[model samples]
Target: MFLDRDGTMIDEVGYLDRREDVRWFPWTIDAVRLLNRAGYLVCVVTNQGGIGLGLFDEPFVHGLHAWLDATLHESGAVVDGWFLCPHHPRAVAAEMRGPCACRKPGRGMIDAACARWDIDLTRSWVVGDRDIDVMMAVAVGARGILVRTGHGERDLRKVDLSLPAGTPVVMDLMEATVLILAEGERRT
Candidate 1:
């Protein structure tokens, strides 16, 4: 499974530049633990455009990920991999400017995860709180689940109206975890 970071796993704070702002939803740890126990490799794919926008540096991103790892570890949940895209189309940071394959709706990060983890798109899933997250999954022949958290309610309007009717939309990560596990059982 591929999960989006902000708005999906952790609470969405616009341009999260500090570790102090990290907020995990109440159900995040348990949901992740569930997936881990179920033999699913939980990978986090996030678009951290803040780096390119000069809001934060790459060190901040790595530091935040480290904090997240420790936090999740305390609860027995483990993320198998993390793929982040720091590039943005309109960036003040010269190095991070321009279009990149790793950004949301782009498959660069996802592709990297697949290569590193040997993930099979046919049996994988992408879970997030935005249309781009689901669209990324669909682009890669994987399942997509949109959760209603953070910008989710707003994105919900678009997802419900725009995404294929078959796409699954849930209340949060906990709900999404249940759905994914159930779907796996059904496939068996």
Candidate 2:
């Protein structure tokens, strides 16, 4: 499964730059563990425009991901890969940032992950706390689940109200894990 990091895995503090700012939700570790045991390659796809904006650099982002990996490892869950886009269209760093397909609401990172990991996008899932996450899932032909953690509830307010048939909204990551596993079983 593809997961968005900022709001889905940890608390949203608006442009997280420091490793000290990583704060995971209560059941997130368990939910990841569940996904791991279910044979899902849990991956993180995040937009780090702060890096492109000169607030931080790629090394700092990598360090934070390493720290997050350590934290999840301690809880017996291992993230398979991390794909981040550090570009924003407009700003002081806009000159430094160019348009890449990896940005959210786009399927660049998702497509790359599928190519690298041999993922079956049609059967995979994406979970995040934003409508853009849902859009990304649709873009990749994967299922989307918006969890009510971090900015989830706030992001939900921004959804287009009208959905195109199938979409999933769960209370949190734990419930999402349950739903994905159940659906996997049904598909099997």
lDDT of 1 by residue, 11-73 (tens): 998888878888889999999999999999999999988888888888888888888998999
TM-score of 1: 0.96
TM-scores, all models, native as reference? 0.96, 0.93
The per-prediction CA RMSD against the true structure, in angstroms, equals: 1.5, 1.6
For model 1, what is the error of residue 33's alpha carbon versus the real structure, in angstroms, after optimal superposition? 0.4
User: Candidate 1: where is the Cα deviation over 4 Å?
Assistant: 159-161
Mark the regions of model 2 whose C-alpha exceeds 4 Å error after superposition: 159-163
Q: Which lDDT tens digits does candidate 2 get at residues 77-173?
A: 9899999988877647656577779888889888888788788888988998888888899988888988888778876686455434667888888
lDDT per model, in order?
A: 0.89, 0.85
lDDT of model 2 at position 107: 90
lDDT of 2: 0.85
